[model samples]
Target: MSNTVFCRKYQKELEALPFPPLPGKQGQEIQATVSKPAWEAWQALQTRLINEKHLNMLDPESRAYLMEQMQRFLDNQETDQAEGYVPPTQA
Candidate 1:
């Protein structure tokens, strides 16, 4: 299997905040409890996965896989935001 390197460290300060899930149009609220460092890492990883062309140049299968991964990352962020998880600001 290939290796993955995500440049992010864990931060506890963000975790201690009271992040109550916001109410949505569907009637109920969604809760998310992600640490600041993990959130930053996830965002960076998503950007790398979406912008990096190296994986696409490797092979058709690799390209397809990367695209799928990118889509999932986007969906996850949307869902998380809808559920009320404020993403960490980019540094």
Candidate 2:
């Protein structure tokens, strides 16, 4: 079966898996594998989110809500990274 089909059929099994089954070599090796420009772009998005969208600016309840969403996004991004979901280069 195609990877898509296989993954779909076993969606639950795939739910929390690291796609490549191996984490990238950590530390410096990880940096070496990442393109400088791509890393810069990801850094920019991270900056925007924390500087403009973080909970510190919100009222307590709204801050809690935004914090929850942001935490989920961060958690998902971590999962995707572990699963080898490289983002496309910015145009």
Candidate 3:
């Protein structure tokens, strides 16, 4: 059976991630609170930010920035967005 979590982002019980996305306590916290859909959306936003902002993964500062953004996103707070990204139109 799929795991379920009280999603911090959606504020409702929803499908949970199968595993922690990272190591250590932070990862465990995410698994306990963040849902699968929220994490997937964060993945897309992170990819866009990396590309649009030309973030250097090797740089400690770049990693730190992404971590901050991830926290904000998961908590339903405003987050830094990629430049020139347009949301898709609904049909």
Candidate 4:
């Protein structure tokens, strides 16, 4: 059977990731609280943030910013948005 966690993002119990998605205490926290779907959603947003903001992972500041955003995202808290980002208009 798969592991289940009380996903903070979804506010419900759901399937957990097979392993920690990141390193350190934060990763352990996430592994115990975040679900796979929520993690995947964060991954997509992280990619967009990197691309839209031209963030360099090699820079400590950039990594820190992303980590802060990821924590907020998983906690269902408000997060910073990329400048000039506009949602696509519905067809």
Candidate 5:
């Protein structure tokens, strides 16, 4: 398989992840569509969201919230951002 894919978030061809970021159909879908940079960005955002929101992974509601956010993010839709978190601008 080619090492690149058209990133659904970016709407352009970009480097793909070496493997699925998660398990099951969701992971496979991300692997087929999301790019390395996009996924990495998501990881950072995910971290911020978790930390800022004090999310408990063991809580089903928290996990579900994160899943919903992840779907919105991957779909290039507006996601719930961390309060006071300003993304670093490209210089």
Candidate 6:
């Protein structure tokens, strides 16, 4: 049996992550409220942000920016988009 959560992003009950995606209280909160699908979406977006923006993970500022974006994304708040982003067209 899988754990279920009332996903804030999807606004419905969905499959939960096996563990928190991050460390600390925020990670625990996300583990409790976010769904696996939503977390995966965030991961995709984070990858785009890193690639498109040429973010350096070694830089604390870059990491902070990503963290802020992640929180906003999970909260369904407005988040920064990758520069020169073009949406892939459906085939």
- Model 3 lDDT tens row, 17-67: 999999999999999999999999999999999999999999999999999
Reference-based lDDT, each prediction: 0.41, 0.38, 0.96, 0.92, 0.94, 0.95
Tens digits of per-residue lDDT for model 5 on 14-80? Answer: 9999999999998999999999999999999899999999999999999999999999998989999
Judged by lDDT relative to the true structure, which candidate is superior, 1 or 5?
5
Any runs in candidate 4 off by more than 4 Å, and if so which?
83-91
Better of 5 and 6 by lDDT: 6
Q: lDDT tens string, model 2, 1-91?
A: 2122112212222222213222554333323333333334444554554455443554787446544543344333431122333558999
Q: Name the regions of candidate 5 deviating beyond 4 angstroms.
A: 86-91
lDDT string for model 1 (1-91, tens) is 3222231132223442134222463112111334434445555664555454345546878656644553445345332112333568999
Residue 61 of model 6 has an lDDT of 100
What's the TM-score of each model vs. the native? 0.30, 0.31, 0.93, 0.86, 0.89, 0.91
**lDDT tens digits, residues 16-72, model 6?**
999998899989999999999999999999999999999999999999999999999
Higher-scoring candidate on TM-score, 1 or 6: 6
In order of TM-score, best first, we have 3, 6, 5, 4, 2, 1
lDDT of 6 at 40: 98
Residue 42, candidate 5: C-alpha displacement in angstroms: 0.5
Where does candidate 3 stray beyond 4 Å?
88-91
In candidate 2, which residue pairs clash? Answer: none
Prediction-by-prediction clash tally: 0, 0, 0, 0, 0, 0
Cα lDDT of candidate 4 equals 0.92
RMSD of 6: 1.2
All predictions: root-mean-square deviation over Cα?
Answer: 14.9, 13.0, 1.4, 2.1, 2.3, 1.2
- Kindly report which residue stretches of model 2 are placed more than 4 angstroms away from their true locations once superposed: 1-25, 55-91
